[model samples]
Target: MPLLRSNTADKFIVDRRKPHRNSDVARAVRRSRDRLSQRHGTPVFDRELLKLHAHAIVGSAATIPLLVLIITAAGLLGGMAGDIVVWAFLTMTCYAGLTWVAHRVRKADASRLNTISTKRNLLAGHFISGLGWVYFATLGCVNCQVEQFPIIKAIVLLLAMAATALITSSLRGALLATFALPVAAYAYIGINSWAPIELVMTGLLALSLPFFSYVASHFNRSSVMLLSFRSEKDALIAELETAKSMSDEARRRAEEANMAKSRFLASMSHELRTPLNAILGFSEVMSNEVLGPMQNPTYRDYARDVHDSGQHLLDLINEILDLSRIEAGRYQLNEEPVRLLHIVEECCHLMELKAHNKDLRIIQEFEPELPRLFADERALRQVTLNLLSNAVKFTSTGGEIRVRVGWTAGGGQYVSIKDNGPGIPPDEIPVVLSAFGQGSIAIKSAEQGTGLGLPIVQGLIHMHGGEFELHSKLREGTEAIAIFPASRVMEVLPALPTRKVAAGGRRR
Candidate 1:
């Protein structure tokens, strides 16, 4: 079935292009698959049209012979019964041949059938049958006294033309081939007799040929359009199938690559960590002279540098792995009820010494008696530490970092870490939030970072059905807010009323 249809597309236009060069062999083998229109007419459309004409003509076969029999009966009212019978027999025989050809063509394989030859034979059959009408028009009716007999003959002839026009319309020139001769004979007979009724009948017949042809042209256009639409629909379906297969292939390759990445990281995690742990341990022991006093002071400095470098490398590795796991959806949250205030307070206390070294002050503010939140406690601690570290790193001497945990406008819980540091530019906020993306301030500052801190925080908050927002202004401060949704904000139940039961335990 066609996927599209229209009612206002009854225009007659010819396709004058040559045969398509692409897929010629395929179209020849299975004409049904042909989607191209060509000068010689599309093979599928031509075959379909021929099949249509054949089937229509075959379907109405019984009626054609009846017309001939009626004409024979009419002509019999005249004095030439024997001649009329012979003419009717010849006409019926011609029609029988046309029907047989149509039936054979219809039953045959459309892909192998010769459309050109079949059309020629059908046209020839129609023309031969018209000769019977010419002979009947000339037959004399001496014994008959019926007036307006010419009109009756004209009506019958017109009816036949109309029926033929509808059936053979798809086969170009078939209608004209059949009726042209009969119309000419009528004109000739009328001119010789010079009778009024005969002349009118002849004129009517002449005019109807073109009118019927015009109407038949519309039918032909409709058939071709239907075929064209079908071809386009098939082509679109083929393209969609091709695109879907390509998408599937791409997704399969991506899945395979992700799996390979996961395996590589999983193995490298143990292998790399083993060495980093050793480097940090030995470097710490050597720098601190845990085993013995160092002979040279320079050796102690070298050990400290090695330890610092190793620690930095370790931090980078951990950040990269965390970001990867979060992005790959492998970081499962150990969800439990944890107080947000305790986590932030502990992180502040931990960073207190580092903040004091830089002459920075860390202040903690909590909404009193805040409810426990459903989240991963370790992740919350990491998020708090990362924010406080950034605050200390970016703040100038004696700058203050304010940590606040409070309720959001939507009845949710939010932890906001605000630092009065050399604030980041508003436009660079996105750069700061993306994985491994640092801003100009961080690049210029002495402090080092993996730049995955904000992204990891965002990911953790999002996994808990929450939102993360970062607001900043130049020369002012930057505040990073992680909002947990109302769903995760554990509701506090009201204490049950003490029952003052006097007798029974079942008190209301």
Candidate 2:
């Protein structure tokens, strides 16, 4: 009983990290209640492990005397080693076989079938052990001198009888009623006079039943509490992880919306400027010479001023449109294999006249074997023009601008425009790449611009799956480079099967 009680106490050990729940206090209460219950009922054993210990205690107490009686009755103290050996083997073999069968059946199936199999094994072990007692009884009766064998034989008979009584009890009842048989049997046999005294003693064990029942109830409550605590802890951790994921997704979506708004504004500007350009171009022709300089002098001058203003506005509109298309994800690349070196040459030729006006020199350097690029030809040309124009526009007279074309370390084509003008500060690099952003030099100079050139160039390079890089130090000039993936020049053919139309028949 104390062995069972100690297992119950082990459950009360304190875990220092979790201080709120302590097992020790619960154990103390259980012990106090046990003592009180013992006074009113039978003794309680605290755990299931102690039930086996109880069986061993009962078995040893009953078997030693029975063996002595059998030996005396058979007159075998002098020469009966074989009989002793046989009895020992019989007892051990029966116990082991019953235990093995129980284990195998429990593993093979674990539902009602297993429960039935387990109880059957328990009954069988008891039945086998009882048979050994019965044999000892018969041997004692036959060999004992006088009256000595009766008491011992009677105890063995009581054990045999009760074991027989509950062998076929229903499964649920067998769990509760099995304890009664062994207890009743031993008590009746131990306390019998000419009667079976041990059998009667076993019956008195019924007095302890209520206390055992209370102990069982407490154990069940503790198991339920432990299971529930584990479930709640798991749920709480899962909820926290889900909340963190949702918060991260919301922040990403907000950033995307802001970028979309900037793109929309830029696109509107471009669309508005296209029509304005036609109007301005025709008006300028009429004011100058298309209609012979007009007959009214004042009307001619007004037309000339209007044309100039319209042209300026048209330039601003085009820049805005370029920015919008890039942001909206509506910018399409006209991919084809084209020589990058040729593109650089064209840019230089177009800007040579402007550089000459400022007394600046334009230098061009191209790698001899540079590969062609799969990119939008028109966009690439516009990117080159923007960079070269900025270089020429920023540099003072006699300053030099260099355009270099080469391949990148990552197997891409690179085009860089360098100027001898005042360079941007390191801190202002990101600002200059943004829409409407002016660098330190540009802000200080008298040059007039919409501040959209670098932003537009960066957007165009990104559309081609490339990068735009700028390196500068104040008054040391700046370098802007656009790097593109390499490609091969080939005759145009039907489109390959790369496109996958969405459910709505649109390309995502």
Candidate 3:
């Protein structure tokens, strides 16, 4: 019977061991699934993860001296200084090793940093460093005989543990592992103590765990959100840069096309002008009967019409070529000293016949003794003629066209042409100033034009260091003014004295 009982006891022990082993296996399976889920679901960028590890290691290195001080102040180190020093040395060694790992990770290729093994190593380093704090909790101040030493030591440890959790909060798994072991040991020590104060300290430490966990969770959420925002910002910047590059390429192509058009027009000018000159010359000869008498009176009338039409076409072509040259920066000016009064008078005389045909009067308002202007003579004449022609073309029968030349407010000179015609609408001013753009008023008027006048005027004035302005009101009148800068006005110098010779041919 005794033999039978020994066998039964052995069987019973084997049965009990089976469940324990099975439970261990099950717990490990659950842990593996949790780690896998964490890895797949909440993926952090490799750089941020590495940064978290480096921060934790550096923080641990900095806390070692504080821990030693706490132990020494508790008087726990009086007899255990050698052991404490050894523990401190070991903790620092671990920190230095982890720091070196962090440095290597930081310097490694980006592809290497994202590997699973690299991340695991970082997690392992953090977990081992946590073990050092657990060692401190177990051996550093656990043997203190003084009544208040345990409380002081526990409080310091709890604070340090909370700080560690916060520092490594960007890595959730590492943070949980880091504080769990030390806090558990501290709680166990507090719970089994005989003193009420120690028990209360233990309760407080237990209650504070959830609070620290919440802090870690909060920090983790914030960090994840910030990383997401940063990633999106970088992506947006890349897209904008791509769009800008494409737009620049398109703009370059457009500029090339425009330059090609200008070159084509410039090349065709000679081909177009030669035929127009022939038409004008032959029509003039036929109209005036310079070669022979026309057999029919109707032939003379037809020849005259042909001459006028050819002249108009020639003017249009000239305006177009002049505008193209100006735009191409090839219209060089023969600049000289010119009197504004004389130019204005000449332009008026040229336009007077057209104005009289429409029964309009030309009015002149000249400032007395105005200074001569330094400018392009031909360009100034064109500017004046264009303005007067427009005034005559737009003015109604029995209307008045006023031309003024005067000193401007800032010691500069100005020439203004005003007309009582259908004035330009304010909104159409820019349209009229652009090349080949006509205002509604000009379009509706009986007389029509090529509409290159104002743009040409503006370009010529700009080249001469001057400003051009147009002011008009609806159905009231319009005024076009060209203002020359003070620099372009020739100041009169005092005349040199002429020395009189005493009836002898000698220099004075």
Candidate 4:
């Protein structure tokens, strides 16, 4: 039943809302909407506007006690605080309702946020709070002759208005409506007062309205920019995560394909080698006339050719198998202590005949008393032989090939094979190093090769914790160097002295 999918497709939507974790109350209060608007622009997101409304509601509620103290001190109630009490009660109730709405919004799913009804509720709360402040501003102590009483009342009203503006400044429309009503009421009351000092105070209050508006605008802008930056940052992080996932998947697939190729090669090599061995054996017998002499000389030559061709094919297969084993991590090295001088001399002696047949000279330079190397002797011999063979194959008749063995500057050992042949071009160095890749010169010359020689050598040297480098230039020469690390270089121990038994039969 679970496997039987529904006919209707399920809609998937990405949620981009970020969690709000900043709870530094002092930072929030200091980042008043007035200051933000001057530095930036009004918040573009509706959620930001809702947040500002909530802050304003809370700020107004906090100022209620202060309002009561000022009212009582001014003696504006004439011993009848009933009117002010009722106004305060209504203001508190409006704030409590706004607080509940804010809490609901904060708890609501992101999908339901920024709805039309939510904005309407927030604006209504702001309007009611504004009206409460306006009433306080208009009903000040008119009968009090004491100068400080009216001043204190005005100060309290101004403070409340400033707090409302700062809190709601994230939303331009909300802030304007909240502060404009109270400021206008105060201006009206001041202008109507017959006292000269009242007129002066009224003028000052009227002048401050524009400054308050400017501050509110700046605060709104700053909040908008901050919110926009956070949104952009979240988007970039999501994109990076997606890219990383794609890259990991691609790498995994590539590794699987490589393993499959290695398995196929291993299977085919075994199958092909069996038939190749029979071909080489029969051709060699016919060429050598093991049973009877060939009736014609041409028949003998043709048989010899067949044997040579088969031998070449067998060598190619062996190279391929070696490279595949190395790549598949199946090649095991039989490690032992090998003298560098001995291995190089043996490889050179084996390739000497081939060089002489081509009329080329083999030059040898050995660093005396070189330390023995801890490595696979067979692998080292193959690496040396491959380099020497390549040099002999590439060099023209009468060219000189130099082979050198020495201790490296860092107390390690190295082998260098240099040939005065038509050298490899600079661009083809990587091609020469890669498997089955032959240089252009080798391809065009009489002697061509399956490009596996250098790759095998490089792989073997790497297994021994050594480095192989091929340096060449067009028409100049080519040099191949393999350097073994110091860890693989064996240290010589001090010789023990032989003890002599002198006059063993004597007691002295």
Candidate 5:
């Protein structure tokens, strides 16, 4: 009953089978497990060990019964011990011979039991061997005839039979039969033949069945579980290696793309500037009456438009190249001593006409004791020009623009440009500083701009190791600030040309 209720019994029992494949299910399971181990790159089990186990199952089943017969015969032949000695030795020899054969069978093709084909063979061999054991038990019972022997001896002979069937082959069936028949026969022997020790031994053997079944079930389950876990771990490690490789590839591609973009910008800047210089130069000559004056005022107007549009295009191209160099981290600085106040004055003077045309007032506030700062003159000029131009562009007619230049001790000098024009919207101020990003005002006004000016100003200032700041509110006005480190500011001045205006819009 314990064996019937056991986990292995529950799984391997006839009722648990589907009836159609029940006869061959164990064989199929063994074959499938073996094949799975082979295909999955798992280490294969030793075939020799499996075959040895199989032979041991069959050989032990057969030998157990014969041993019982020999012992019973020995007891019965006691009276004619001397005369039957040779026969007994002959019987013992046959038993040893069969055992030796079983050992040889086990040794043959030991690796074969782990294969799918061999596992089926092993299972079939077990069943057939069990049937052979039943036959052997029948022989012993027939030879020890019931009519000649005492009933007790005959019964003891029958009871000892259960041991001949090795429990390892079909564990479930072996366990049940081992307990049932042995206990019944032993009980009969004890009551009828006064062998209580034999009854106790039989009882003890029956009790051992559940413990062995429990241990065997867990062992099989543990083997399968460990294999499953190891397989999953290996697959996960492989996937991680693949992902790391892809990530490294993506980083390499990003760097290459950035390099290509910088090369394109440098090439485009040169190409565009070449033609633009020729157009502006020709326009300047024409405007100066070098061709004896344009015969028609319309011709002059056309020439002026050409000059202005060409310059505008050139400015856009230059800004794009500047931003490209900054993003690529290839922009270099030329350090020179610069009069901070003078540079601020030059920017105000340049934007004077544009401010007047818009009717906006200009105001300059310079701290008289400002120190000469070390900086890149061309970059500072561009930064100052951008701030002034943006302020003028957004200012309404009759607004005020204020320019301030001063020093912040221990750190740097600051240039502040403030305008009371239609100010930047709070949400869009940061966006306007980004490349190709414009504010709501510029979009609504249909402003003709490439949107690269502010970004270039920020880049130029940062290259000088300075801070560029902005403060604005919608419709109020914007304040643009630049701060440069004092240590980078030059301590000595070199003889430089005085700031000169382009006389009548012509560079001198």
Candidate 6:
């Protein structure tokens, strides 16, 4: 009455475990990731690092000139505006050269770059800039009006060191190369002056240089890591693309093969059936003694066997054609309003002779006064007969086969045919339900079957927007239920009200 669940097979269960087919692709991706991770200093990433260094220098091009202007303005307050201007001019000239080199490098292609040579040139430029700072270390006026000029100069040098570390972080060893000379110059000038403030500043600058260099190195490593992650992401996307292409290729081949099979079967239907019908006709005449009595009884018996074998072959051919039509989406449904109970009952009657032969008893139960079901009448008949035949064929002698027709809780209609046959194993339910598939019991039985009964039934039910469920348990029994939705169960319409016209040809 509730949603009649198929307990025999866990058809709705999705298995998360699947055989992995992309091991080679996965291994290649891993290998690529590992190689990218370790190849930071190699030619590929070296080119990337160079490009980043160039961009960093060019992007913040205004900062250096601005710092120089501020320093010149501060020095002008020393009253030696002439010396201050000269220093600014020379320093500005050095920075202008550095900026030009960075801009050129940024525009240069990978082919033009020699990583080692380019790095050396950049390092030399930084060292030249360091010479400018060396001059700054000794440029302060001792007797100037400002008392903290030395401290200001020391702070300025430290600031410059910090900025250079940030700017050249992408290019390895550039920070140390730039500030190495300046720190030495500052320390020498400080120790000679014998000023505690200068000496203390000098020691601070000495320690700060290495610290800033380490910071730059750390930043460079971070850049390498970012590149690694980016490369891995690109690799994954590429692998996905390759997989998609391969899948498309396989699908195209499969579709082509399916089309070829359809064409072959279409030709074979006429080819095979023409000869088979001849075989059946000749065998039937001989078996029935239609022309005359056979001379030998053995000859008559052989003719009967031939006729039976031909009939079986014909059944198998018909089943194959029906399944193909269903699978190829060519099986169109001719839906009509029909009695569900009557059709199932009739199918039971049709199969009664076969059940009687097997000494099996079929019990039929129908819900009375059920509504007409909208379905393909022929398909419904075939579905019921297939199920019934399977029951009669497999059911043991004196076994009871129960058939029920009733309304579902959802107001839908269902027909269930259950038999106390040597039941299907739980694992074999799927096999039995597949086209040309048989269970171990069916295999061992003396009964001959093409094994397409349940599958054809399932296809027919599906065509009518219904569910076909096969329930079975080892040694207990098997039940095959075909359920049609409420939509297919046509409701009885209300009778129309009639009124007579009063002396006119019009109805009120």
Please give, for residues 360-384, the per-residue lDDT of candidate 2 as tens digits.
9988888896656777789989999
lDDT of model number 2: 0.61
Which candidate, 1 or 3, would have the higher lDDT against the true structure?
1
Determine the C-alpha RMSD for candidate 1 after optimal superposition of all C-alphas: 12.2
lDDT winner between 2 and 4, please give it. Answer: 4
Write model 4 residue lDDT over 285-304, tens digit each, in one string.
99999999999999999999
Those runs of model 6 whose alpha carbons end farther than 4 Å from true positions after fitting are: 1-41, 55-112, 128-147, 497-508
TM-score for each prediction? 0.70, 0.47, 0.81, 0.78, 0.51, 0.81
Measured with C-alpha atoms, the lDDT of residue 471 in candidate 6 is: 85
Span of 10 residues, lowest total lDDT, candidate 4: 13-22
Tens digits of per-residue lDDT, candidate 6, 291-390, equal 9998999999999999999999999989898898898889989889999889998888888888888788889888899989888899999999998888
What lDDT does the true structure give each of the candidates?
A: 0.82, 0.61, 0.75, 0.75, 0.63, 0.84
**lDDT-superior candidate, 2 or 6:** 6
Tens-digit lDDT track for model 3 on 324-442?
A: 78877888999889998898898898888888899999999998887788888899999999999888888778999999999888989999999998888899999999999999878
TM-score for candidate 4: 0.78
Clashes of 3: 0
Q: Taking the tens digit of each residue's C-alpha lDDT, what string does model 5 give over 1-508?
A: 3544444432212232222223244444454455445422232532433443445555565565466456546645544343234434544454454445445556666433344554445444444433432322222223443443333433443443334333333222333333344344444544564555545544554455455455544443454455456545655554455555556656655665667677777766778899999999899777776869678888788888889889988877877888899888888888777787898898899999999999988899898967677888888898999899888888888999999988766657899999988888889978899999988788887455778888888888888888899999777889999988777765554555455343534663
lDDT tens string, model 1, 178-227?
Answer: 88887888788888989998998899999999999998888988777766
Model 1 steric clash pairs: 17-39
The lowest-lDDT stretch of 10 consecutive residues in candidate 1 is 9-18
Query: What lDDT does candidate 4 reach at residue 53?
Result: 51
RMSD of each: 12.2, 20.1, 20.9, 9.6, 20.0, 10.0
